[model samples]
Target: MEAPLDPVSAETVSISADQRSRPYLRLFLISFVLLFAELACIRWFGSTVILLTYFTNIVLMACVLGMSVGCLAASRGRNWINAVLPLGLVAIGLACWTLQAYERGEMSIAAGDQSAPQEIFFGAESVQQAPLGRTYPIEVVAGLFYALIALMFVGLGQVMGRAFNAIPNRVAAYTTNVFGSLVGIAAFALAAALQTPPRVWFALALVPLLGFVTRFRPIQVVALVAILFLVGWLPPARNGAARQVTWSPYYKVVFQPSTAVIETNNIGHQQMASIGNSGAAYLLPHLLNRDAGGRPFEDVLIIGAGSGNDVQAALSQHAKHVDAVEIDPVMASIGRANHPNRPYDDPRVSLHLDDGRSYVRKTSKKYDLIVYALVDSLVLHSGYSSLRLENFLFTEQAYRDIQARLKPGGVFVMYNYFRQGWVVGRLVKMVEKAFHMPPIVISLPYRAKITPDQNQAGATTMLIVGKTEAATAAIREKLAESGAFWIHVSPAKNAALNGYGAKAPEVEGTMKEHWWKIAPSVVETRGIGPLPSDDWPFLYLRSSMIPGLNLWGIVIVAVLSLAILARFAPPATTRPNGRMFFLGAGFMLLETKGVVHLALLFGSTWIVNSIVFFAILVMVLLSNLFVVLVRPRRICWYYGLLIASLVIGAFLPMDSFLALPGASKVILSCAVTFVPIFFAGVIFATEFRDSRHPDVDFGSNIGGVILGGLSENLSLVVGFKHLLLLAAVYYLLSAAFKRRAEPPAS
Candidate 1:
């Protein structure tokens, strides 16, 4: 016998050929299963439950260990996998159990009106919530997941024994590692350019690249290029579809009041005009001057110090020192850079770059006057007046905390933008509870924008003055003088100001008015709604509609995606497999998810427009060029999936939970929206092996990512939630394709 014709070479060739088909089919199945799971879980449970699912990290670690052990046992022996399986399964069960808690809707903080501010210490037990999944805290779950993956890798490596020796030649290993690093660097760079904050999301997008590149197949490079492009292009592309079209950098500016200016660039114009007319500015000087008002306050605390107007009032008074806490770094920078009154430079003004609540915790310094000149409502980013953190900031506990920071003769003044709505009433009650004094609720009228009706809900900026002492004639006299100095808060009524006669409902300690209903009409108004043509979905869809000849600007992206995918394709083999498809799909999905989620949660007027017209094109070109140049293997797929899932599951659900009614509905929607994305990542991560021509696979995966981003933005025009269903259908189609292409089992 010809000694079996040295069949080892033939076997190697066959295996190499088969590898190309493996990943493609596997990814299709994986994506399908995951997508189905997402829809099913969300439909049944709700977003809250899905958000809570991050706590399942406890179980995931165990499951990973079990999976690793099982894989090891298949290769090494039964004993090893079996030994770890019990513990792993137990952990998985525990994770599932913990996730179930979201079903009960226990995530929201309890409503309370406890007065008399005391120090708050979250304590060991309360800190249990720390590791609970949410966007900000996703690191907790991601870090744990990574640790588990590392453990599994180490254990698996041990089981491989001699087989591990044949892993990669020096050249192959170095090349693969470099490719992997490049993929990671490219994905992160793309994510960063898009203004995506540090999270597991970037990691997940790179998972497929890691797996495909490891196969040493050139087609893997295409996957990397696709992913990068998807992320780079999707955001800008969405901007193209907006309805109202206008670009005004003036929208960002802050200016003084003037009717001559039909549209002022400055953001503070409306407030300034209202304040100026109300005679609040005139009275502010009087309140500050001790000789005039006999106001004994030596120091004052001001929050939301917009345009430094409040600081100017403080400077007028003989305040020993004034502490102002403003959250927006941009506002602070702008004030220092351009504001006539540089509060940062003011001798008496000590500017604090921190949230009001957080800053209060660190400071023991007492102030005679604490003025919360915050925008009538609390929204984190740029908005006229929002109710984002209103509950926390206006609570009884918060007021009491403010009281603790005040001196014996101190007064706490809150000027809120409130109509005679339930929000105002609740606020008054909450403040009364803290001080044990009836609020001297004075109505200051100004015509501001309203919700449901663009111009009319008759909103008035209400001044609810609370002091330790009763307001006598003398106090009223002092308040009148102080009101004159603060222009935004008026002492007089104008026709421009809306009426505030409607009685507001009372809010109790345990039983509170519904936030939405009682939420003041003032807060409901979408302050300066998203600018025309700046709608996120519109931008993406518009970009896509541009003709290729005109869209030739992103030529580099097209080239890169094709080039990378080409490089990864097995030159000698015909079939396409695991090393290719997963990377491609994962990349696209990552880009899509990030852009859509960001646009939805954060205000996207300027951002989406800018991305569509400018940033994305540059990113697409850069991503393509980068992939064509460098390639790596075993891209960080496992870690990426783990992180992406944690971020989406934890943070993304807040909107749905807030938007939807029932706990189950919220949880279920969240699960459906998130799970499919998570599973897509997992499939990509599962491919952690050496490959051929890592660059090609790298490019393909990246290109896919670019597509994913594009798809997300396009989905915006089609409908945000509807896109989730579309994603599911696409995954199913992919799965069917894979099943058809796959060979029959032995």
Candidate 2:
């Protein structure tokens, strides 16, 4: 009967008080579904799309942008809710098909990541690029997928927008939304915990989505089936090649038993074979360790011990105690079940399913030999940021920790097909800096095309670091005595070497020989380049700045986001609550800072991420309750508190906290990390309590999240600690922009 007033626009919803309970329940359900779907989209797209495995934040920002657009569309009475299924199918189907084409080497749909020597993308070079003018270049493929992912989630956002408008009490409605989102994140975490496949993720998301539809057409039914079927089994090349897919918390692990090879997120991860042929690379480090005089490394620690090839090699080398540390359980299980040598089943082998850095921090027993065996993570640590899982593992701080774990005069070996000279050179410098001695770096002598004067550059390189007097000296003496101890490379080229022998693998003739002692030439000549540290751990990046590909991607996303908002969002006749927008932006930063801060204190593991998300949500819930019950006044006071908290956090350094007692470090770290978030939540909840147009206002908030996600990239340059100051500025902007308005309706 009432043409209700929505202050932001002329649009009105004919919602009644009696309709509250069901609509609110539906709102909760819709929030749950959408959050779960968003998480699924991020994970699935990162794992399925070829180049996007390194672009998780793009997926995240797309979801935020989509939500903002869909929520704003709510006031226009346009419903994309029914389109969710079809859009989702299109997004998933497109990814699957593209991935199939990629797998078959039929197409190149990369994200302008190729030709990037400044950053390392594992499979970018292998992608067959289409000519720039002829085909829609693979670079644009990521943008297309970004739009598709955004479109897929627009329906969920629209439903939430509608539900928010249905309830008269804005605070209650928002609280419900937060609670629902909390549940949704938890649900996804549970799914991750269960190690559910993509099909189960789709099914879980589909159940709540059906509640939003007034009636289910046959098209919807078929689309639902298509979503499940395509996501579960499409990209037949991937499935058929692997025969089985295991969803780890961090990746889609494809174990190809027939080939004894493992792939994660569409990239070659590791191979499980004996020490005779392909596995000979693993035995090189042991052979190089001449401390026991051909007796082998007695106590070995292999970080990133994927599929037990190194462990197998260790046992073959007669390692008395082998501590094999692998981060992924699925990868470990694959090794245990199918590794030809059955390394994990060996009595002397102790497999630790934990982060390498964390394990190093906790382990007190020094190792006779330590190996970093092709330790590269194809995926980022958290979807919220552009940091890979292996970033921390390669930092100077990490190397120092490894040094502590190594027995005095013990050997530390790192080998990988570095592809770039700068990477190899950079690693050599970090090793020298940490171990206080130059490492014996064995790599084909070549200059980096991108980096100047990096001698020991491309191909498979081994860096042997040690205490000069004992293990390393023994190896150095062995190199001079008979030159038969070997590099971290076996004499058998492709064949796995059964044991040590005085045989050099044939090299391509008429090429320069490798330099066994790779000096820090670049560091001395050009001044040292930025080395990764705990504060700025970016192992793959050439420097602290964002890569060219990422910069271009960000610019395109910003432009597209503007265009989408201009086209689909509610008319710009009325001004949005700027405070809400900035508050949303600030909240995003706070959450990001909390995640990173805690990750530095704890390990960058999936469990840490889940707990941080849960804790942040819980903080929001508490803040909402405080807002409703306390009915706090003066948004300025809350802003002050938020800024104060951020300042306090900025002053507290991450590395300094590592020495604190375990419980004490966690308490102090979480407080510094989350206290600012609580204040931001309070400010948002308090202001939201009296909002005139819930849909428009909430949509504006989502827009801020997109900004925050974009702003997060600045951390690459400024580091995470300084982000606190940036967040503080945002809260200040939020406070400055706050409108003088009417008091509470009560």
Candidate 3:
């Protein structure tokens, strides 16, 4: 139906096009220089300290070089088979690597049961264990898979240059990309509330729409940053330093509350939270009853081993062997090097750098006393105002795994930080429900000058003890006879009881006696309870509304409005090539999401969050400056788009991994930071290549990011990390769309 296309010469484009994009090349050089600096940092400091920094540098450098060279090589618009094909291969590699990280399914840091028989009865239970298996080697394989996928994504970016040229009504494509991103974000955000079938479709469609949005205008960047910051600061967002207990008079009320200690090291001196030593000090006396402590504990299992204090204490107890499961590797390393007390030296202590749940599941050996110093609630209890809930850590199945690993008569000790009157009842209820046995609770009141009611005042730590049914009734009777505290017994006969032994809170609706019915089976199996509808003062820490929650639904309508507005406006002053606006926007959004997600993956501190927020802010400010400086020429504008995309792709990861893993938490942070950053850099770079204008590009990119943030929070409701994976794929698809649009000229 079409006239012959003039034999579509392979190298027919103007020489001016190459000249036009040189600025983009120059920008790429700057990006590479930045990455070289990061690489220098890694070389001088060591990988452990600057692990994230290293990867970020590599990703940025690769993306910059790839884009700059690829685009330069194809200035004359070569056919897709020659120019874009190689880039597509690279994108595919990157995508595979990025996606591989979560393919193994997320596991906790603590060790627990691994090979236990699944309960074939429950309908939804199978869904939970579907991905469960020997996942260690699988994890590495998965990483490689994602790496390849990322490569594919990069390749896709190279092909996009040609695709946009073929489309009719270029302005319409720009509007569609922006609108598509907004719609995709809305769809992803809403998927959390809807049923599975509809949500699946939304999740699937979200990827390409995201790809389309990445290629937009710069004004959208500011709007996107505003949205990201809004979501980042959402009340429910998780922060760690928010609730860290400072040294205070009330310290006595909380046994084993952490202390910050400054120590000198080769890397210079810094302060770190010391928890294991304090916990060991508190528990050591009880383990040997202060007897001649040449060696008291024969065998030990330490859950949540902080700073290796418990392991040292166990060593002091001279246990023949100890299985130490510390959830935070950063902390573990600190303990290994500077803990003042090191357990790694002990031949008996075996360090398992696995999640506590999985460790217990895999190991059949039982210990004399299983010390669960940190409970399931603590998993979600970051010391921050942002309510980031580690939802998987608190499920009912976790408790059952613990139960399965314990010897029939083994004692289980946990620390419950609550000192309120009726709160003890709730804790006891949770314990009984999980243990399926009556627990003899005892409160070790730390007698200090502080009052308990002054919640801010540090008081002595009170201990909660629960024993199995096989434990002597005399122990229970003794607990019951202690009239010094209020106690609550369950309705069931001879059921587990809470030895609160204290008066209730004076507030209205506060009751003196404490007993609540809990689903024993649920409690015994998984530590997780039903998601609470109403916020509990002790439990609920933060809140936030998703961005553009209402307006997002009509993004298509909004694009239409923009189209009408564009029709009446001064013809864009300078319109970008085809879908460039959409592609650029997708890259920006993908880069930001990648930074944040990488932070989560590597266990990096909230600094990554700060960088992400700041980068967006900087991007907006810089874009405004460029608009004023460059005066809207097509080549300059296009260069501006390319520069912004490359810089974003390169730098975001650097910000993510600047802080290296030193202590347990630090190591966790390192692990979290790199993967997300690498993937983000790769994906964004790919997307940017296909983007046209700055405004729509920025808008759609930001919209995708907003959706990513929203998805992170909503993960509490959904079961898998698939949502996160989908977000990364969205960027990949954008790259693919670019390739499709730009099929190399034959």
State the C-alpha lDDT per candidate. 0.36, 0.75, 0.34
Cα lDDT tens digits, model 1, 1-746, are: 11121123333455664664443343332222222221222111111122222122222222222222222222333223112222222323333333333223232221011111010111111222323442223233323333333232222222221122222221222223233334434443343334342123322433332332223443344444443332222111111332111112112222222221111110112232232233353234234234233564578888767556676666654567889886544455555544544556878788875557545645778877777774422111111101122223454546667777877666677664332233444555556667776554443342222332232123334433434554223444444443321222332321122112122223232122221111122333222222112122221011223323212312433343334323322224423333334344433443344343433332223333234223323333333333333322323443354344544443433244323444664356435444544445333322322223222223223334333333443333433434443444334433333311111111
Over 4 Å off in model 3, which ranges? 1-281, 284-297, 336-343, 374-392, 416-427, 438-467, 472-478, 481-699, 715-746
**In candidate 1, where is summed lDDT lowest over 10 consecutive residues?**
113-122
Using lDDT as the measure, which candidate wins?
2
Q: Candidate 1 or 3, higher lDDT?
A: 1
TM-score-best of 2 and 3: 2
TM-score of 1: 0.36
Q: Which lDDT value does model 2 have at 719? A: 82
For residues 90-164, write the lDDT of model 2, one tens digit per residue. 888888877777765566655443344656676666554633322234447778888888887788888889889
lDDT of 3 by residue, 261-283 (tens): 32111011123323332342234
The stretch of ten residues in a row with the least summed lDDT in candidate 2 is 1-10
User: Once superposed on the true structure, which residue ranges of model 2 sit more than 4 Å away at CA?
Assistant: 1-18, 110-116, 128-139, 238-242, 291-295, 444-458, 481-528
